[model samples]
Target: MASTILVTGGTGTLGSHVVPLLREAGREVRVLSRHGRASADGVEYLTADLLGGEGLDPALAGVETVLHLAGGPKGDDLATRNLVRAAARAGVKHLLYISVVGADTMPIGWFRAKLGAERAVAESGIPWTTLRAAQFHDLVLDTVGKMARLPAVPCPGGLRFQPVDAREVAARLAELTLGEPSGLVPDLVGPTVYGVAELARGYLEARGKRRPLLPVRMPGKVGRAYRAADNLSVTGALKGHRTWEDFLAERVGQ
Candidate 1:
């Protein structure tokens, strides 16, 4: 029997894509979530809180591989530290973590938290792989969708994104999870880089809506980091096939 692999945040968007791929590979899958769930589709569901470190011992018992996909706007460092401690005690062989591109470069609180999470995984004393990915098309869509609701969209100049499909990231993660630990793999990103204005315009065009875009400069060091494209992986990155336009066409224009 294939050893069971535990996935945290398996119910979220990225996890939604990843869980099935693992199942298709004939691996017994376990998902750790905050709420209780019934086992279905060959996946065992376990209730645990990564942040408060509750129920982890039970969750990690006999699990050799862990995909640490659970994260949030804050406290990711603490949550990851909590999970790593348990994974260590449980004798997990391989630990995989999903982090964001520019987690170490961007001067933002969320980025800092992600970097901290990365640190925790690296220091966990277990074989680990961490893949930093660019922003997902779904997340960008939400950002632009909310912006479209305003009369005139505040398009922050120098704010750019390479929005990749979540499914593509999931596939990559599944491939990595099944293999040996490869530390800090090359980043995964979309095929094309787009300015924030370009992304917003694409969304507007897809929805058949019209909105004037106000060009505004982002201030402070945070803005400087964006302007420098610190959040992008323009070189030495594995690019996904789908473009922002393709995603918009399928999700909005259709």
Candidate 2:
């Protein structure tokens, strides 16, 4: 009999892509979410709260592998710690986690939380694999979209991004989940790196709107990190094929 795989945040952007791939591979999928859903076909949906550490035992029962994709701006460390304790108790064989590229180097609360979560997964005493990925195109779109709404978009000096497609990250994660545990795999990044101004230009052009970009200097340690490209994975990382242009063309239209 095929083993059951547990997926946290299976309904999210990346998880939405991952769950289907695992299902198509003839693997049983159990999605743990904050909301309850009726189990259908071969997928099982369970209501659980990783942050609050509630309803974890029943969720992990009979699950051989765990794909932990759930995260947020804060409390990720605590949430992941909760999940790790439960998975350890459940005797789960493989534990997989998705994190951001600058989790360690970036001096930010969010990145620190992500790094904390990574540490939790690694120290859980279970076989584990972690893939630190660059920012998703969807997230970049959200940021740029909000900026476009303003009369004058603020283009922070030295702010740049490598926006990888969510689908590509999802596919890599699904592949990792099915394979044996490989600790701290290579970082996944997009093909092209774009400055904030360049990204805004693409967005404004796609919308057929032009706004004056106000050059603003970033301040403090955060600014230094961006200037130094601390969030980027320039080399020794697996690059995704899709470029930001490809994403803009498909999402915002030519």
lDDT tens per residue, model 2, 1-254: 97899999998999999999999889999999888789986899998999988899999999889999998879999999999999999999999999999999999999999999999999999999999999999999999999999999999999999999999999999899989999999999999999999999999998899899999999999999999999999989999999998899999993
Worst 10 residues of 2 by lDDT: 33-42
Model 2 clash pairs are: none
Quote the lDDT for 12 in model 2. 92
Error of 1 at 113 (Å): 0.7
lDDT of 2: 0.95
Q: What's the lDDT for all of these models?
A: 0.96, 0.95
**lDDT comparing candidate 1 with the true structure:** 0.96
Per candidate, the number of residue pairs that clash is 0, 0
| Predicted structure 1, TM vs. truth | 0.99
